[model samples]
Target chain A: MTTYNLALIGFGGVNRALAELIRDEPQRFSSLGFELRVVAITDLAFGSLVQGDGIDLAAVLAMPRGSSFDGLPGGSSDPRNEEVIKNSPADIVVEATFTSPVDGEPAVSHVRWAIESGKHVVTTNKGPVALQGTSLSKLAAGNGVRFEYEGAVMSGTPVIRLAHKMLGGLELNAVQGILNGTSNYVLGRMEAGLRLDEAIAEAQNLGYAEADPTADIGGSDVRLKVAILANELLGATIHPSDVHTTGIQDITSDDVAQALANGLRWKLIGEARRESDGRIVASVQPIALEADHPLAGISGATNAVSFTTDLLGAVTVSGPGAGRVETAYALISDIIAVDDFVKGAVRA
Target chain B: MTTYNLALIGFGGVNRALAELIRDEPQRFSSLGFELRVVAITDLAFGSLVQGDGIDLAAVLAMPRGSSFDGLPGGSSDPRNEEVIKNSPADIVVEATFTSPVDGEPAVSHVRWAIESGKHVVTTNKGPVALQGTSLSKLAAGNGVRFEYEGAVMSGTPVIRLAHKMLGGLELNAVQGILNGTSNYVLGRMEAGLRLDEAIAEAQNLGYAEADPTADIGGSDVRLKVAILANELLGATIHPSDVHTTGIQDITSDDVAQALANGLRWKLIGEARRESDGRIVASVQPIALEADHPLAGISGATNAVSFTTDLLGAVTVSGPGAGRVETAYALISDIIAVDDFVKGAVRA
Candidate 1:
C-alpha cells in the first residue's frame, strides 16, 4: 500500500474537512488504493506544527478556537509557511489559503515553493490557479511534479479535470458555466419575488455569501475562475483582467419576474470560446436563458458548466459549487491525480 | 508512438463513422499520443476482410451498401466474425453490432470470443454489456485484457466512464438518467401539443427514432441501460428483467399540457439506487419532473445522467445520446481506456 505524506498549508475549513474525512474514512482511501497521512500543518491563527512521521489530526482538530500549537512537538506560534512547505518531508502540499484576487500572493508563492522543492501541489484557492497557472504548471511539469487545482473553477464539480481528462480528443469550441453559487442563489430568490438586497441577505444568512460579498456579486470572482479555465483547459494565455465581466447586479426583481413570465430565467453565466479568428474570448455576464437551456434549470446554490464540442454538441455537468467537504473532495481528487502521476513515473 | 491494430465488427454507421474519422483526422490521434489502424473488418452485409498491414478505410467506407468484400484481397463473402476476431492481428476489437434485447446473442459471443482470445474489447452494443457484462469483464480480467462499453448506455455521452474514472472516491448512492433519447424527444413533442403517435412520427422524421421504435417507446431500451448501469457502476448483480419498467406512451398531450401548466416536464427516467438494506432497486418510468430537477432540462435527443453521491450532491452530465460521429467517439474513448489500462498493466 502506497502511503503519501501531506503538508497542509492552511488550517481552514476546507483542509479541516479533508482531515476529518481522512480520520473518519480509511476505507475511502483504501478503495482508491492509497493511504494519506498529514505530516505538517501551518495556519494564520492556529500557528504551525510539523511532525516528520505523522501528526495527530484528532488532537489538532479538537483544539480550542484561539489556542495555538505552542505545546506540540516542532510547534511555533508563527505560521512559517514557506519554511514548512519547502523543507517538510511531504510528497504533496495541500494549499487552502484565502484567494488574493489582485496579485494571487502567498498562495502562488506557497505553490511555487512546493513545486520548486519537487513536491506536488493540490490547492482550493482560485488566486494562484487563475493568475499564475501557466507558469506554475510548466514549472511543476518541468520539475516532474503536478500542480492540480480542481477546486478553483467549480469547487469539486470536476469542471477543469473533466475537460482535461474525460472530454479528451474532442474539439471543444466553447465552455459556458453558471460559476458562482451566491449569484445563482440570489437570482433564484429574485425570481421568487425577493429583491437583490433581500436575496443577498438570505444568501449570507445561509452561509453562501461572505462578509465581503463584493467579489461574489461583482463577477470578479467568476472572472478569476474563467481565466483559470481558459488558460488551463482552452490553452489560452489570459489574465483575470482580460475577461469582460458584468454581474447580476443589474438584473432586478422586475427583470427576473418579467423573464419568468416569458419562460426565461436570469443566470450569471461565465463563458469562454475559441473564435474563428483564433482568439479565445472569455466573459462573465447575466443572460436570460429559456427553460430548455442547459444552465436554466440550475437553481439554488448549484453550479453547472456546458461544453460545446464539435462532436458531442453541448455536454453539461452540474453539481455543488461550494461547501467545505465538497471543496475538500477536490483536494482528494487532486491527490488521486498526484498518486496516478507518481505511480506512472515510477515505471518511467 | 503507439499504434493499436483494431478489428471492427459490424462495419455499420458507428464503425464507418470511426473509419471516416481515422481517415480524415490524423491530428486527433497524434494529440492523444497514439495511432489507430483498422486491420480487420467484419460485416453481415459486406462479409469479412483482414489485412495485417492495415486496410484502406477510405476505399471500404466509400464502397456501396449492397457490395460485399469478395473482390478485395483477403476478403470473404461470409462475415466469419469469430475467426476474424480471434485470428486477426488486432490488439482491440471494436464491436458495433445491433443490440439484442432478449438474449444479447451474437454481440455477446463476439465480446466473449475477443476476450477469450486475450484481446481487449470496446463495444457500442447494449446487448453484451447489459446481459453478460460481469462474466465478460471477469474473463477479460483473467485473460489480462479489458472490456469497455462506454457507448452502451448513452451513445458517446461519457456516462459510464464519467462515473467510473472521474467520480472515484465518492459514495455513489443512486444513478438516474434520461437514457432513451427517442422517448424524450417524443415527450418533448407531446409537450408541444402533438399526440404520442404524431410525436413519434416527428422523432422518426428527424431521424431520432427507428422504424420499429418499440424498444425505445416501450421502455425496454431504458431497462437494459438501467440494468447495465446498476450492474456496472453500483456493483449489483442484476439482470435487465429486474427493472420495473414503464414508458412515455401513457403520457398524453393533455397530461403534457397539465404538467407544463404546473411547471413540470414528463421524462422517461431510468434509475438504480442502493436501498438501506443493501438491495438495489432499478426502475424505468415516465416521471413528471419539476423544472429544477437535474434531468428535466435535457431536451430533444440529448441524454443525461444524475449521480447522487455522498460528497458532491447530485452531479449531472448531459449530452447527445445518439449520433453516428458521436457514438463513434465512444469507441475512441473506450480505445483510450484500453490504452491507459495496457500502459498501466505494463508497469504492474
Candidate 2:
C-alpha cells in the first residue's frame, strides 16, 4: 500500500473533521490502496507541530480546547507555516485557513511554497483560488503536482469536478447557481414570513452563518465562488472584485413575500456567463425566479449550479453547500485525486 | 499528439450524430492533444466499412440514404460485426445497438468480443449493462481496459460519472428520478389536459417515443436503467425482471388533473434503494410527487437523478434525457475517458 504524508496549514473545523474521519474510517482508505498520515499541522491560534513519522490524529483531536501544539507529547510550539512547507516530509499540504477575498494572501503564498517544495496541495480556502487559481494551476502543473480546491465553492458538492470531468468535452456558455448556503437559508426563512434580521439570527443559531456574517450576507462569498468558476471553467482571469455584487442584507421580508405572491421567490444567485465576443461577465445578487426555475427549488442550506452548454442544453447539480464533515470529504477526495495523478504520472 | 481509432457497431441516429460532431469540431479534439479517426463502422442495415488509415466522416455523412458501405472507395459490403471487432485496427468500439431488456443478446456478445480482443468499449446500449454489466466490468478490469456506458441511461447527462467520480467516498443509500424522457413527456402532456392516448401520440409525433413505445410506456426502459444503477453503484446484482414496474399508460387525464389540483404531479420515477438488511429494492412506476419534491420540478423530456447519500444528504443532477446530439456527446465523452485510460496504462 502507498502511504502519503500530509501537512495541514490550518487546524480549523475542516481539518479537525478530516482527522476524525481518518481515525474512524481506516478501512475505507485502505480499501482504496492508500494510507494517509499528518506529518505537520500549522494554525494561527493553535500554533504548529512537525513530526517526521506522523502525528496521532486521535490524540490530537483529544487535546483540550485552546491547547497549543507544544502541549502534545514529542511536539514543539508554533513552527512557522513556511518551515512546515519547506522542511516537512509531506507529500500533500492541505490549507483550510480563513479566506480573504480581497487579497489572496498568506494562503496564496503558502500554496505556492508547497508547490515549489514539490508537494501536492488541497485547500478549502476560496481566496487563493478565486483570485489566483489559474496562476496557481499553472505553477502546480509546472511542478508536476496537483492543486485541488473542490471545497472552496460549494463545500463538498463537486460542481468543479462535474464540469471538468463529467462535462469534459461540452462547451459551457453560462453557470448560474446558489453557492452560499447561509444566504440561501436566510432567504428561505424570509420567504416563510421571517424578517431579514430574524432569518439571519436563525441561521447563526444553527451554525449556518458565521458570527460575523457579512461575507455571506454581503454576497462576497458567492462572488469569490463565481470568480473561481470563471477562471477554472471558462479560462478567464477574474477576481471577486470584478463582479457586481448585491447582498441579501438589503432584501427585506416584504420583497420576498411580494415575489412569492407574484409566482416567484427571491434567491441569492451567483452567475457567470460568456458573451458573444467570449468575454466573461459574472455577478452575485438577489434575483426573483419562478418556482420552476432550476435554482428556484433549492431550499434550506443546499447549493445548486446549472451549467448551460451548447450540446447538452442545461444541466443542474444541487447538494449541501457546507458542513464540517462535508468540507472534510472534499479534502479527502482531493487527496485521492492527487494519488490518481501521481499514479498516472508514474504509469506514464 | 496521441491518436485513437474508433469503430462503430451500430450506425444509428446517435452514431451518425457523433460522426457529424467530430467532423464539425476537429479543432476542439485536436487542441486536446488527440486525434480521433473512425477506422471501421459495421451496421446490419447500413452494411460495413473498414479503412485502416481513417474513414472520412464528412464524406460518409454526405453519402446518400440507404447506400451500402461498398459505395465508399475502400470499404466492403456488409462485413459482420464480429469480423470488425476481431480484424479492425480499433482502440475503442462504440456500441449503440437496439437494447433488449429481457436478455442482453447481441450487445453483450459484442461487448465481450471487443473486451476479449483487448479493446476499450463505450456503449449507448442499456441491455448489456443492465444484464451483464458486472461480468463485463470484471472482464474489462482483467484486460486493463475501460467499459464505459455513459450514454446507456439519461443520454449524455453525466449521472454515472457524477456518482463514480464526485461522490467518490460517500455512502449512497438510494437513487430516485425520471429516467425515461418519453414517459415524462407523455405525463407532462397528460397533465396539460391531454388524454393518455393523446399524450403518447404527441410524444411519438415529436420522436420522443418509438413507433413501438411499449418499452418506454410500460416502464421497461426505466427498469433497465435502474438495474444498471443498482449493479454499478450499489453493487446489487439485480435484473430488469427483478424490478416491480408500473407503467404510465394507465394514468388518465383525470388522474393527472386531480394530482395537479392536489399540488402533485404524475411522473414515471425509477427508484433503487439499499435496504438496512443489505437487500436492494428497485422499482419503476408512476408516482405522484409533491410540488416541492426534487424530482417534481423536472418537466417534459428532461431526466433527473437524485442520489440520497449519508454524508452530503441528497445530491440531484438533471439534464436532457435523450436526443441525437445529446447521446452523441456521451459517446464522445466516453471515448475521451477510454483514451485517458489507455494513456494511463501506457504511461504506467
Candidate 3:
C-alpha cells in the first residue's frame, strides 16, 4: 500500500476543502487502494506549516481568517511557497493557488519547482496549464513525475480526461462549452427579464462572480480554458490570445427576448475545432442556440462541454463548473490519475 | 505494434458498419497504437466465413443481404457460430448478436465459448452482460481475458466507462437515465400531440422502433439496462425481473400535454440507486421531469445518464443512444479496452 505525502501550495477554499475531505471521510481515499497524508501546507494568508509527520488538517482548517500558522511545529508566518514546494518531503504537490490569467504566475513557478523536485503535481489552477503546459509537461516527463490539471477546465466535471481517455479511438472534431458559471447564470437571469447589472449583482450575491466580474463576463476566463482545450485535446500550440473572444457583456435584454421569441436561447459559448486544413480554430462568443442543441438546456450555474466526434456525433458532459468541494474533487481525481500512473510504473 | 485478429459473431448492421470503419478509416486503429484484422465471421443470414489470413472485409461487406458465403475460401452456407467462436485463431471475439431478453441464450453461449477458449471478448449483446454478467465476468477473469460490453446500454455513448473511470474518488449515489431511444422518441411525439400508437408507428417509420416494438414499449429493454446498471454499477445481484418497470405504453397524449402545461416533460426513465442500507433499488418508469432536470432536455432519440455524485452534485452525459456507426463505435471502444488489457497482461 502506497501512502502519498502531499504538500498543499495554497490553503484557499479548494485546498481547505481537500483537507476537509481527508479529515471527514477516511474511506474516500482508502477505498481507491491508497491513502493521502498532508505533511506540508503553505498559504498567503495563513502562512506556512510543515510537519514531517501528518499535519493536523482539521485544526488548520478551523483557524480563523486572519490567523497565521506561526509558533507551531515548523510553522512560520511567511508563506515560503518556494521552499516548501522544493524541499518538503512530499510525493505529490497539490497546487490550488489562484489563477493568474496574465502571467501564469507564482503557481507556474510552484508547479515548476515541484516537478523539478521530482514530485507529482496536481493543480486546479488554469494559469500554469493553459499558458506553459508544453514546457511543464516535458519537464515532468524528463523528471519521471506527473503534471495533472483536470480542474483547469470545468472544475470537477472531468472534461479534459474524458476527452483524452474515454474518447479514445474516435476522432474528436470540435468542442463547445459553457465554461463559466457566472456568465451562464447571468444569461439565464437575462432570459428571465433581469437587466445585465442586476444579474451581475445577483450572481455576486450567489457567490458566482468576482467583485470585478470583468474576466467572467469579458470572455478571458473562457479564453484561457479554450487555450487549454486546444492545446491539450486538439494538439494546438497557440496561446489564449489566439482565440477570437467575445463574451456576453454586450448581449442585451432585447436580444435575449428576441431570441426567446424565435425559440432560441442566448449563450456564451467557448468553442474549439480543428479545421479541415488541420488548423485549430478556437473562439468564445455569445450565440443564440436552438432549443434542441445539446447545450441549450444547461440551466443556472451549471457548466457543460459538448464534444463533436466522428462516431458518436455530439457527446456532452454537464456538472457544477466551480465550487469548493467540487474543484477539490478535481484535485482528488488528478491524484487518482497520479496513483494509476504510479501503479503502472511499479508494474513496469 | 500489435494487431488483434477478430472473429465477428454477427454480421448485422452494427458489425457491418464496424467492418466498413476498418475498411475505410485505416488511420483510426493505427493511430491508437494497434491494428484489427477480421479473420472469421458468422452470421445467421450470410452463413460463416473463416480465413486464417485477414478476410477481405470489403468483399464481405459488399455482399448482398440474401447472399451466403458458400463459394468463398473456408466459407460455409451454415452459421457455425460455436465452432468459429471456440476454434478460430482469434485474439478477440466481437459479438453483436441479437439481444435475447429471455434466457440470454446463444449470445451468452458464444461469449462463454470464446472466454473458455482463452480469447478476449468484446460484445454489444445485452443478453450476456445484463443477464449473466457476474458469471461471465468470473469466467473471463478465470481465463485471464477481457470481456467488455460498453454497447449493452446507451450504445456508444460511454455510460458505464464514464461513470466507473472518470467519476473515481467521488461517491456516486444514483444513476437516472433515458436509456431507450425508441421510448424517448415516442414520448416526445406524444408531447407533440400524437397518441401512443401513432407515436410508436411514427417511431417505427423513423427506424427508431423495432417492428414489433413490444419490448421497447413494454419497458423490458430499459429493464435489462437497469439491471445491468444496478448490478455492474451499484454492485447489486439483481435480475431484470427484480426491477419494478412501467413503460410509456400507458402514458396518454393528455398526460404529456398536462405535463407540458405544468412545466414538465414525461419521459421513460431507468433509475438505479444505492439505498442507505446498501440495497440497490432499480426501476423503469414514466416520469414527468421538470425542465431543469439533467435528463429533461435530452431531445429526439438522444440518450443521457445523470450520475448523482456526492461531491459534484449531478454529472450528466448525453449523446446518441443508438445508430449503425454509433453502436459499431462501441465495438471499437471495447477493442480499445481489449488492447489495454492485452498490453497490461504483456507487461505483467
Candidate 4:
C-alpha cells in the first residue's frame, strides 16, 4: 500500500474531525492506495513535536478528549518548540490554524513555508486566502504544489470545485448565496418573534454564535469569502475592502415584521454580478426576497450557493455551512483532490 | 496545432449541432491540444464517403440551408456505399445512428466494431446503452477505451455525472427527476386551459414535441433514460421492461385542470427509490406535484433532478432537457472528459 506522510498544523476541531473520518474509513483510503500517516502536529497550547515516521492515529483517537499528549513518545517539554517543522517526515501539510482577518500573518506564514518546502497544503483558514490569494496561487504554481481551501468557502458544499472545475467550460454570469450562517441563524430566530439580543443570546447558548460575534454579524466573514470567490471566479483582483458590505446588525424586528407583512423574508445575501464593463460588482447586504425566490427558502444556518452560467444554467447546492464533521468533510475533499493531483489522476 | 482524427456515423440533428459547436469554438479544442477533423461521413440518404485527412467545416457550414451534401467532395455514387467505414482513418468514432429499441442489433454491432477497432466511442444513442450497458461497459474496459453517452440521459444537465461522480461519498437514497420535455410541455399547455390535442399540436408547432410523439408521450423515452440512470446509479441491473411506466398519454385536460384547481401540477417523474429489502423500485409515472415542490416549478422543456443523499442534503440542477446546441454541449462535455481520461488527467 502507498502511504502519504501528513502534518497537522493545529489539533483543533476540524483537524480532530478529519482524524475521526480517516479512522472510520480506513479501507476506503487503503483501496485508493492511501495511508495517511500523521508525522507531526503543531499548536500554540501544545507546542510542536515530531514523530519520526508517523503517529498511530488509532492510539491518538483513544486518548481522552481535551487532554494534551503528555505521554506520547515525542512529547516536548517546551511550549514554543518547533521540532515538528524542523524534523517531521511529512509530504502534505494541513494548516488549520486560527484566523486573524486584520493581519493574516500566522496562517500566511505557515502556507508560505509549506509552499517553499514543496509540500501540498490544504487549509480551512479563510484569512490567508482572502488576504493573499493571487500571490499564494502563483507561489504554488511556481513550486509545483497545490494550495486548496475549499473548506474556507462553504463547508462541505462543493462550491469551489463546482465553479472552478466541474463547470469550467461555461462563462459564469453571477454567484449569489446565503453565506453567513451565524447571521442567518440570528435572523431566522428574530423572524420567529425573538428580539435581536435574545436571538443572539440563544445562538451563543446553542454554541452557534461565537462569544464575540462581530465577525459574523458585521458581514466581515461573508465579505472575505465573496472576495475569494470573485478573485477565483471572475479573475478579478478584488480585496476584502472592495466588496460592498452591509451586515444584518442594522436589521430590526420592525423590518422583519414589515417584510413578513409584505410577503417577503429577510436574508443576508452575498452576490457577485458581472457588470457590462467586465468588472464584477460584489455585495453582502440584507435583501427583502419574495417567498417564491430560491434564497428566501434557505432558512436557519444552512448555506446555499446558486451558480448561474451561460450553458448549464443555474445549479443550487445547499447544506450545513459549518460543523465539526461537515467542515472536516470539505477539508478531506480538498485533501483527496490534492492526492489525486499528486497521483496524476487530475490536473493541477 | 494538434489534430484529432474523427468520424461521424450519422449526419442527423445532433451530429450537425456538434459540428456547429466545434466550428464556433475552435480555440477551446486548439488550446486543449485537439483539432477536430471529421474524416468520414455515413448516412443512408447521402450514402458513405471517405475524407482521409480532414473535412473543411467552414465550407460545410457555408452550404445552403435545407440542402444535404448530395454533391459534396465526400459524396458517393452508390446510396448503399459503406466506404466511409472501410477506408477512413478515425481515432474517435461517434455513433449517433437512429436506435431501434425493439431490436438493438445494428447499434450494438456498430458499438462492438468501434471498440474492437481500438477507437474511443461517444454516442447519444439510448438503445445500446439501455439494453446492453453491462456488456458494452465490459467490452470498452477490455479494449482499454471509453464509452460515454451523457446525452442518453438528461441531454446537457449533467445528471449522469452528478449521480455517478459528484455525489461520490454520499449514500444516495433516491434519484427522481422530470425526465421528459415533450410530455412536460404538453401538460403545461393543458394546465393553461387547452385540450390535449390542441396542446400537443402547439407543442409540435413550438418544436417542443415531435411530429410522431409516441415515444415521448407514451413514456418509453423516459423509461429508457431512467433505465440508464438506475443501472448506473443504484447498480440495479434493471431492464427496461422491469420498470413500471405510466405515460402522460392517458392524462386528459380534465385531469390537468382538476390537478391545477387542487394547487398541483402534473409532471412525468422518473424515480428510483431504495426499498427496505435492499431492492430498488423504479418507475416512470405521471404524478401531481405541488408548486412548492422543486420539481413542480420546472416547466416548459426544462428538466430537474433532485438527489436525496445521506450527506450533502438535497441538491437540484435544472436546465434545458433537449435542444440541438444544448445536447451537443453534453456530447462535447463527454468528449472533454474522455480526452482527459485518455491523457490520464482523470481516473475512471
Give TM per candidate.
0.97, 0.93, 0.97, 0.86
Candidate 2 wrong stretches, greater than 4 Å? A74-79, A252-254, A345-348, B74-79, B189-195, B252-265, B290-293, B345-348
Residue A291 of model 4 has an lDDT of 63
Candidate 4 segments whose C-alpha is farther than 4 A from its true place:
A44-49, A62-66, A77-86, A181-218, A248-267, A287-302, B62-66, B77-87, B99-106, B162-165, B168-173, B182-206, B211-218, B247-268, B274-277, B286-301
| Candidate 1 residue spans exceeding 4 A from truth | A345-348, B345-348
10 residues in a row with least lDDT, candidate 3 chain B: B339-348
Clashes of each: 0, 4, 0, 0
What is the per-candidate TM-score for chain B? 0.98, 0.96, 0.97, 0.92
Q: How would you encode candidate 4's per-residue C-alpha lDDT over A1-348 as one tens digit per residue? A: 668788888877888887876777876466555777788777666655568677777777675655666666876634332345434677888888888787677888888888888888898888899889889989998999999998888877678776665664567888888888889899888988998888999999999899999888989999988988888787888888999999988899999988987978899988888998998999999999876455665667878787777766665656678887777777767777777788788842
Q: How large is the i-RMS for each model, in angstroms?
A: 3.0, 3.3, 3.4, 3.3
Q: Model 2 chain B — which ten-residue stretch has the worst lDDT?
A: B339-348
Which of the two candidates, 1 or 4, achieves a greater DockQ against the reference? 1
RMSD (CA, Å), each prediction: 1.7, 2.6, 1.7, 4.0
Model 1 over residues B83-130: C-alpha lDDT tens digits? 999999999999999999898999999999998998999999999889
Error of 1 at B176 (Å): 0.7
